[model samples]
Target: MSSSRTARWILAAVAAAGAYAPAWAAELPDRTPGLWETRALIDGRYRVVRRCFKQGERSAFIDAVGVGACSASAQKTIFGGWMMQADCRTPKALLSGKLLVSGDFGAELQGRVVTSVTPAAGGPVVKRTAMTFSSRRLGECATTPRG
Candidate 1:
């Protein structure tokens, strides 16, 4: 898959894991709202991305997780964290994966996800990839986008 597509898949998995939080915890963990930098290890390569979190957007992250064209199940809390299995279908491929996240979500957060993607056609081959990521708050957002 292309680099952009891979990044999106990893982000989606992370978001889904965050979504799994509500099923196990009554309230969402507090996170610093501002510029956050995330570094992900995909296929042995490191990629860093940044996102600006506006006020109230943090809460939306909880509700937005796993709310798209995906189905998630087998959610459980483990060792002060959350885990779940999920499957997502796109026009080009079907992705099934397991997501695990650990942290208080206040200042630091970490997660790991493994997914297998099967193409709609081409061949019967399935590609498997694993991604590990961590995010740290970087003070206030540099530029807040208009909503």
Candidate 2:
């Protein structure tokens, strides 16, 4: 085989491997059941909030990225974390983004999501938004009895 033919075959094989890899998409472990304090930074502004997760609950950070009509394009494990890519459609815009998450779910977690949005009826303009967040488990949540 000529050098170019051999190179093309190699590239094809790599592409085929990637095509099937998403079938085993790696997932981040669920957050621990308890209260968590989450701090987020967006556009140089900071906000903190607390939330409680029940047993087998997904991380709030993960939920934030899945808002609106989204179809996950890819997921994989990387750098002691999981990375997810998706495209989403909302009433006003179409967005594409990636979320990167890391840290042990038992005690602390860190994540960042960056998305680019295009107006549904716009020309070639795109708006980009990003948020960086970190959460620490803050013991158990207080239980409220239902009357």
* Candidate 2 structure quality by residue, lDDT tens digits, 69-128: 556688878988877776655556665666777887788877776766677676553656
TM-scores, each model vs. reference = 0.73, 0.69
Report the number of the highest-lDDT candidate.
Answer: 1
What's the residue-level lDDT of 95 in candidate 1? 66
- lDDT of each model, Cα atoms only? 0.65, 0.57
Candidate 1 lDDT over 14-102, as tens digits, reads 63234333343454454667777778888888888777666545433334334464665667678887777766666677667787878
Alpha carbon lDDT at 86, candidate 2:
64
Backbone clashes, candidate 2: 0
**Candidate 2 — what's its lDDT?**
0.57
Kindly give the stretch of ten consecutive residues in candidate 2 with the minimal lDDT sum: 11-20
Q: Which pairs of residues clash in candidate 2, taking residues 3 or more apart in a chain or in different chains? A: none
